[model samples]
Target: MAALFSKMLTKTDIESCLCIRASPLGQLPFEEGQRVNMHVHDESGQEWIFSCSIEEDENVGRFVSVGWLEFARFKEILT
Candidate 1:
């Protein structure tokens, strides 16, 4: 499948406190408050499913919430 977007993980990304920010310019197909299943694949071709909700903020626009930190941890991402 084609990628919707990509980000080089930062220290904050692996932290459990934050969610992955989707680009405002990317214009995701889903609507706000919509729950979507995200398929994440690692470099080794390992795949993980994240059940995320689309959240909108006045300042940040859209972001993927829930299961991101777990995905990072499962991938053993250090950064």
Candidate 2:
């Protein structure tokens, strides 16, 4: 499967939300306001499903509205 996008995890990403850069918006298969299932997997083959909403911000552009904190906790990511 092709990757929709990828990002290097930052402090904000682990503590807050995942931001999708505006430059790749045009290449995304989904549109703004669409809800999509985000499948995330770790190196050990552990997987998690996150129901996310695609949203646009006036200042930040587009981002995946997901329960990032929950995922971060599961992955043992330190804040």
Candidate 3:
């Protein structure tokens, strides 16, 4: 997984920590409050593993899963 930021979309998000919004990544293996490794990859082979959970939105193709780092890292990377 390549942590493609360009492909991220936020519906109703929790912007406190990292948010890996699950719309892009399909079939995540996690239960509600269950900690799992979210593997993300970018186009250039850069990857990120987010300590994530199956939030209130746990649909296979329409929910957002967040990484505790996307919030912190996204800001640093952009500016």
Candidate 4:
């Protein structure tokens, strides 16, 4: 049970952290409406703890990024 919880929470952390790093204009190469999933762990010793891609917004530069919780729901809707 703990392991399952950890996995779920890990994704949340990654998403939260990424949102902080993404541009407000959404111009950082991520598609406006695409969902990205990646493992975020600090063992690699890099500034970036994970990798991501935005795969779908019509106006990539205009779509504002939301918090992790909201983005998760948005991604679900996109799918």
If scored against the real structure, what TM-score would every candidate get?
A: 0.59, 0.65, 0.45, 0.24
lDDT of candidates 1 onward, in order = 0.67, 0.71, 0.55, 0.39
Q: Which digits, one per residue and each the tens of the lDDT, describe model 4 over residues 43-76?
A: 3543222344443344433332333444444346
Cα lDDT of candidate 3 equals 0.55
User: Which runs of model 4 end up more than 4 angstroms from their true locations?
Assistant: 1-18, 24-27, 43-79
Candidate 1 Cα errors over 4 Å, as ranges: 1-3, 8-12, 17-25
Kindly indicate the candidate among 1 and 3 with the higher lDDT. Answer: 1
Better of 1 and 4 by TM-score: 1
The true-versus-predicted C-alpha distance at residue 52 of model 2, in Å, is 2.6
Question: On a 0 to 100 scale, what is the lDDT of residue 44 in model 4?
Answer: 50
Cα lDDT tens digits for candidate 1, 1-79:
6765566755655665345577733676677678778787787888877777777678877777655667666667645
| Deviation (Å) of 65 in candidate 2 | 3.5
Better of 1 and 2 by TM-score: 2
Residues 1-79, model 3: lDDT tens digits:
4434554434333345444556566666665667777666655777777666656644433444565447345545423
